[model samples]
Target: MSDAAGTDATVEISTDGACLGNPGVGGWGAVLRYRGKEKRISGAETETTNNRMELTAAIEALALLTRPSNVVIWTDSSYVKDGITKWVAGWQRNGWKTAAKKPVKNDDLWQRLLDEEKRHTVQWRWVKGHNGDHYNEIADDLATSAARNLRDAP
Candidate 1:
């Protein structure tokens, strides 16, 4: 865990999600930064969707932050980023239903993300995938590794 950039002691997280098929093996990866150093965390599910993996990556990353701090999160999933930063308030006002009057998907993970979000001041940024960003590439690699592991695991 070496400091790649010279930033203050704040948490910077980058997450990526991968799925073999729409409802097939999937995985998520997150790179957590603190004091210029990084910790990589990832997991996989045998049967899941890309959206779930995306939300799971963010959820897992936020869970790693033990204390409230100025946090920056970079994600490739618009759903995860937009859902929290934009749509969450309206959803809450509407009793967790979408604008189309449909129940929100992944309510559990969304609740966890919202809870963790309340505990910290987070800045969400959407990054384009496969754009040669170092942290984003690392997260993508970790996610693909997790998906491969899931497929090979007994």
Candidate 2:
């Protein structure tokens, strides 16, 4: 992340993902805060998984940075947090395979996330979903609403 943030500007981001079903309409959202300013971004997919949407939220959040930054990301998905912070190196070393010698699901999104992450110092923090966290709640609402809109699209 040294290259991602040439200066010392720090950004706070909260991200969440939602799906109508495990492999159904999905959406992702992120709220980015920097120096008292906030920006919200969200998108939906007609067919996707929750994990993909979660990963998309992170990737999109990082992609929004115009410059390198110290980014602290809050997420509710352990799969996202652990996969990036803990298991990514192993997966990469094994050529994107899991410990059980299985092809890693959502490897494409993982690669995109890694690519976006390289441009910033990213710290992933996991929060419990559906709790009272304000930022997380907003992000969750954004995602769930987007997904629902797409699910109910005419």
Best by lDDT: 2
The per-candidate count of clashes, in order, stands at 0, 3
TM-scores for every candidate against the unseen true structure: 0.91, 0.94
Question: Which number leads on TM-score?
Answer: 2
- Which residue runs of candidate 2 sit more than 4 Å off their true CA positions? 1-7
Clashing pairs in 1: none
Tens-digit lDDT track of model 2 for 53-145: 999999999999887789999999999999999999999999999999999999999999999999877888999999999999999999999
Judged by whole-model lDDT over C-alpha atoms, candidate 2 comes out at: 0.91
Provide the overall lDDT of each model, using Cα atoms, as 2-decimal numbers.
Answer: 0.87, 0.91
Position 19, candidate 2: lDDT: 93
lDDT of 1 at 118: 82
Tens digits of per-residue lDDT for model 1 on 33-107? 876577999999999999999999988888877667678899988999899988988988999899999998888
